[model samples]
Target: MGISEMRRTGEGIDERSNFIMYHKGEVAGHRGVGFLVKLNLKSQITGFEGISDRIAAIHIHLPNHSKNWTVIQVYSPTEQATRTDIDNFYNNLTEITEKYSENNLVIMGDFNAQVGARAPGEEQIIGKYGSGKRSENGKKLVTFLLENNLTILNSVFRKKPKSKWTWLSPDGKTRNEIDYILTNKVKEFSDTGIIQNLNFNTNHRMVRSCLCESGTKKPRPKAIQMNKTQISNEIWNPITAPEDLMTVATSDIDLKEKYNKIENKLKEQTRTDITKSQQTYLSEETIKLIEDRKNLITKKDKKENQKEISNLSKQIREKIRKDRIIKRNKTLENYISKTGGTKKALKELREQGKEWITKLKDKNRPTISRNKIQNIATDYYRSIYKEQNPNQTKTQLPAKQQNIYNINKIEDIPEILESEVEKSIKSQKMEKAPGPDKITNELIRGFQVNGQNRT
Candidate 1:
C-alpha cells in the first residue's frame, strides 16, 4: 500500500515473494503484488497474470467444479496522489474486471479509499457498518464498485464500532475503513470482520471472511490397497527353477544366449524387489487421501486436509529410510560371505579403480570444454609415442657399460595362469566406467562366466 513504483526490468533481483508476478519472459523487481496462499491451496492454482506492479491475479479451479475462480489483489494510489495516477489505476482495474467478467471474481486489497456510511443511492453496494465520514477517494471507490456490480463485503457484515474500522491514524484519534474485500457473488461469503486480537506490526488491522460453496458434494477417489505380507514374501523367496546344464553346455549355442539366461533371472529379481519396496514404503490409503485433498477448493477444507497428508507423508518417508538401512545391511552381509574378509574386499576395490583416471586436470587451470580436453589428451599421447631418430647426435655410452646393460632377453615371459585371470575378472567392480574398447568391467566379468575370456 506504500508508494507504488515500477521495477526496472532485467535487474536480476532475487524473487523473495511467496508468489510473484512478472512480465512475460522478463523480471521486474519493483513494487509487485503476490498471493500468500496456504501450502494445500498451492496445487489448485491453474495460472497467474501480472498486469502491473500494483495489480496481479491467480486463477483457481478445483476438481469436480466446472466454474473457475479468479482472485485479483490490488493496491491503489492514495487520495493525495496526482489525478493522472488515479485515472490510470481505475483504467487498469476496469480492463481487468471486464476480461474476467464471466468467471467468479474476488477483488481484495488496500484501495487507500473508503465508502464511509451508506449513501442515499449506494444502498445495494455498501451496508450500515462503514466507519468515519466520506472523503474524495471514498466517492471514487464507491463509483468503481457500482460500475462493476460488486459489493463491499466489509460493510455488509455488522460489527462493533471499534471493530468496524480497518486503519487507525498515527495520533490514535482518527479511524477509517480504507481496506476492503469486494465480490461479485456476495451470497458466497457468510461473514466478514476485522480480527482485533491478531498482532500485525502495521496501522491496518487484518480482515478475514468465511466463504462456503453450498450444494457441492465432497467425493473421494477409489483406493488401490496392496498387501505388505504378500509383497515381502515375493521379494524374499528364492528362485527354485532347475538349471538346464546340458543345454548350456551345447557348443552350438552362442555366449549371448547363456548371458541372456542369467541376465533375465537377475532382471526379474530386481523388478520384484522394487515392487515390494514401493508397496511396503507407501500405503495405498495414504495415496488415496493425498488425491482427495488435492480436489478440495476452500481454504478451511485445504488446511484440514494438509495436516492429515503431512502426517501420512512423514510416515511413508520413515518407512523408506528403514528399508534403505535394511538393504544396506543385507548387501554388506553378502559381500562379507563372498569375499571371506575385509582384506580381500579392499584388494578387489583397489583393482576396480584401474579403469578410471586417478588424477584430474589442475583446479587452478582455466575451465575447458569436453572436446578441448579430449583433443589435448589425444595430442599429448600422440607426441609421446611418435618415432624419434635413433642415431641422433647424442652422447654415446661406454662399450663396457652398454654391453652390461644389454643382457639376454628371456625368450618367454611365463603365460598368465587361467586362475589368476579369473580372479582379476571377478574382482572388477560393476557399473564402473568403460575402457578404450567401450567395454565395462561388468561385461568383461560376464564373458568369464562360461570359461570364455575376452582380450
Candidate 2:
C-alpha cells in the first residue's frame, strides 16, 4: 500500500535493499509521502518521485499489461491549514499528474475534505453517495478534480452511510468521508468501497477498489540447458591433446584445413550433448491451470475466480522459480567440472571484465534493426573511401624521394634474432584485438616452435 504524511527523513535509507522511500526534505521530517510496495511488486516499479511532502508518485509496469500505471498518494492539508500550503500541494500534484498523463493514473489518500452529496452540476465528478457536508477544502478538491478530469471513486460508489465514512472523531460523535480513491480512468475501476473491519490503529478506514485491466498473459520463454562439461570432455580434451597437436604440427595440411577439422568436431559434439540435455521445464499441469484461470477471468467471476487465479499464479511462479534454480545449479556444476574447480574465481573475473565491454557496446549501438545498421555502416564507409577525382592524372614521386625510400634493400636488412622475436611476441598485450588471421597474441605465444613453447 502507498502511504502519505509519513513524517520521516530519507537519509541513510537503503534504496537498493527493498522498502524504497522518497521524502521531500531531509531537515524537515514533519510530513513526507512515499510508497510501501510489497516484495513481489517492488520489481515492477519503473520510476518514482517525491513531488513534495504532500504528494508522492510511483510508476509501475504491471505484468501482462501494455501500459504502465502511475499511482500518486497525497496528504492534503485540512481546511484550517495555511492557504500557501494547500496551494503548493495542488501545484505539485498537478505537475506530477501532467508528467504521467499517458499512464493509467490512480490518486488516493486522506484529502481532509468531503464532496458531500453530489450537487446537480457536480454529477460528472462526484456521485450522490458522499457523507457529511462539503467544507471549503472540499470545494477546492472538487474544482481540482474537475480541472484534471478525475473522478472521485469513493463518492461515485453507493454504500451505507456507515461504510462511506472513512474517518471518525476522537469523541466518537463526528464522522466524515475525507479519505478517497480517485482515478482519471473511471471505467477501469469497476467497484469501490470502504473497508471498516480491518483496523490499523488509525482513524481512517481502508478504501478498496476493483480495477479491470485489459491484457493477455504471455508464456515464458523456454530455457535451453547445455551440458558444457560433456562437450568439453568428448570434444575439446581430445582436440587439444599432445598427440593431436603433434599430428597436426607434423602434417602438411593447410592451416584452414586444420581449423575446419577442429571446428566441425567441436560443433558436432556440442549439438549432440545439448540436444540430449534439452527438456521442457514448465509442466503440462501448470499450463492447464493457467488456461483455467484465464477462462474464469473471461467469465467475470470476480471474487472467488480472482482468488483462485491468484493462488494458481503463485503456484506457477514457485514452480518456475524452482526449475530455474535447478537449471542454474546444474549449469554451475558443469562449469566447475569443465574448469577443474577454478570456475568460481575465473567466472567472477570474466563476468566483471565483460560487463563493461557489453555495456559500452550496447550504449553505442543505435536502436535500429540489424539490417538497417549494417546498411548505414556500409553507406558511411563507401562514401568516405569514394574517389573524388577518378579521371585525374596520377602524379609520380621525385627521383631523389624514391631513392631515399629504397635505401633499405632486402639483402641489406639484418634477420631478426629468435630471442628478440620471442621477447616482442611476449611483450604484446593479450587483450589486444585479433589481426586479419583471427589469431590472438596469446595464441601465437602458446604455439610450440623448435620443440618449445614460444613464450
Q: Pick the candidate with the highest TM-score.
A: 2
340: Cα error in model 1, Å: 34
The global Cα lDDT (0 to 1) of model 1 is: 0.62
The digit string of per-residue lDDT tens for model 1 on 1-455 reads: 11223344421112221332322112456444555554445456555556666776667775554678788877788989999988898889889999898988888878888778887888778877765678788888888888998889998888888677777665556778887888887888899987763321245777777776566667657654556466456533221221233345454667898767655544444445446434433346545644443443223433344455455556655665666566555555766887655554454333221121212254446322333445557787999998788767887889987776565342445789978886888788874645543445544454332344432
The residue-level lDDT of candidate 1 at 149 comes to: 88
- Residue runs of model 1 more than 4 Å from their true location after superposition: 1-31, 63-65, 216-455
Candidate 2 stretches with Cα past 4 Å from truth are: 11-29, 216-455
lDDT of 2 at 426: 74
- Alpha-carbon TM-score of each model against the true structure: 0.45, 0.47
Candidate 2: 10-residue stretch with minimal lDDT:
352-361
